[model samples]
Target: MVYRQEIMLTGAGGQGLILASIILADAAVQDDKNVVQTQSYGPEARGGESMAGVILDIDPIYYPRITSPTVLLSMNQQSFNKYIKRAGENCLVIVDSTFVEDVGNQPAYSYPITARTRLELEKEIVANIVALSIVNTMADLVSRQALQESVLKYTPEGSSDLNLQALELGRQLTHSYD
Candidate 1:
């Protein structure tokens, strides 16, 4: 079967979902897949709503927008409530349990992403990297090497070790969920 994925990552503006989307798109490209990414955030910037869309396919992509996401990552309750309506029936729904209190019957995989990042990693900013790794691992979207390379390439210097640890933690968290 032809491989295709429409992924949407949503959260508050400062949560880094846009960066995650970019990293995912970059990883897809590294794996030789055709990919497109787009993002939008509310006026408040840091606290406002934010969403990023990424589409990956083995064949050429005709549309850049995501109408029905095959995978949805919601970092907060507001984004979860707003974007869950657009997910495909079989979409993989993953939510950050730290900020999202409810899933409302949508079979979602929940993780304490922010809590883990803050408590375990001692840095909450890397929560986006955690979330990205979780989504990538759960969805089996790209090779681990490709994803790791993309994460390293996008993350700032001196932060590679923490980001890699965050990625591994995410993978561990996903396994624990199952």
Candidate 2:
């Protein structure tokens, strides 16, 4: 089977979701997959809406835009409300339960992403990495080693251990859901 995915990651601008998308795209490339990534954010740059879209396929991807995402990850309530409507009916929805209280009857995998990052990893900034790890584990999107390499490559110096712990915590959280 040809591997293909249209992934949308949404949240506020300061949430680091764009970086997460880049990491995911790089991991896909590391796995020898063709991938394209794009992003947009509001003027406020921090609290304003932000979204990143990534398309991955074994075959060539002619278009980079995501009209109907196969996977949707929303980090906040506003993003969840805005982008969830654009998702396909069969889209796999993942929400950060710490920020999104209402999933509106959608079959969403709710995780305490920011809360876990703060409580477990002691740094909420790595919540994006945790969320990426959760999405990767749940979707089986890429090799764990590739993802780890990408994470280490993209993250800042001296924070590798925390990010790695965040990744493991995310995987453990997904398993706990099952």
Candidate 3:
């Protein structure tokens, strides 16, 4: 597999973009690869725009920021518009269809990520984990075992099961092709 892949995840503060990025970065670390994780969050972390960038490669990563991303995931409408413009032809863009009514003209995979996490999974904070699960499945950049292990490693003492469930649920969402 190609090792150098830049992932740009953007969303509202409460949407879990940073958490998802951290999960992806840690998974890369576990794979014995070079990885860099960074974030851009607004003043209102709860409601404001938030983004996390993860770059992983066989070679050491020098800069933390993404120059060009291979994947772009945006939750809120604002973030979708902001980052959609940055996407190239081959980029995979994931949007939370719950809040992002308009996908613009970018290359994307529009999904009701938040809605599925809330209504289907019956969880709130678990949405980010759910979203990351879809990303991992779609890209194949991060292995399934690596991501699951990352969740097991860093999840809070009691929430490991929920996180794993969320990941499984999210993975299921992608296969249905909805």
Candidate 4:
């Protein structure tokens, strides 16, 4: 049986974690992979923490909740520290190094994901899309065409080009590791 792949996204609210997860999940669907997504957040929308978990399988995806993710993207220290240990052994951990100084163990890759977006996209929220691009590339999780299509269709209206840059930036970050 073809193995399943799982990915998790975490960060404070307004970082675009939920938006990025939707694109990734949609891309998996386009590839005919079974997909499940779950998210959690605190009381308010702007300042609290948030997270998204996505599970993809070649066969049926029974549960929507992730038991153990194979890939993790964390933009804050709190979410990173909490879930870092729960991820699988071979999992790839991607973090925004500018804000997170303490990511414990398990093979991590750090990038100024949020900071770069603030400069390039002129907005802090677009960082999640940029980070998602890197996650997709590093994991070989989704095709660029699939990503492009989803970004175009799903991004908040009038924010297309900015989102595109986020995806490209994410793609660029993966090269540093290779």
The clash count of every prediction, one per candidate, is 0, 0, 0, 1
Candidate 3 lDDT (Cα, whole model)? 0.86
Candidate lDDT values, in order: 0.93, 0.94, 0.86, 0.84
Model 3, C-alpha of 82: deviation from truth (Å): 0.5
C-alpha TM-scores of all predictions: 0.97, 0.97, 0.94, 0.93
lDDT for each residue of candidate 4 in 1-178, tens digit (9 for 90 to 100): 6688889999888888888899999998888888888899888979688998889888888878878888999888988888887877788888898788877555689988877778877887777778888888888987789888998888778888787877888888778877
Q: What ranking of all candidate models by lDDT puts the best one first?
A: 2, 1, 3, 4
- Assess the local accuracy of residue 29 in candidate 2 as a C-alpha lDDT between 0 and 100: 92
Error of 2 at 33 (Å): 0.2
Kindly give the stretch of ten consecutive residues in candidate 3 with the minimal lDDT sum: 102-111
Q: Ten residues in a row with the worst lDDT in model 4?
A: 98-107
- Looking at model 4, how many pairs of residues clash? 1
Number of clashing residue pairs, candidate 2: 0
Which regions of candidate 3 deviate over 4 angstroms? none
Q: Using TM-score as the measure, name the better of candidate 2 and candidate 3.
A: 2
lDDT of 4: 0.84
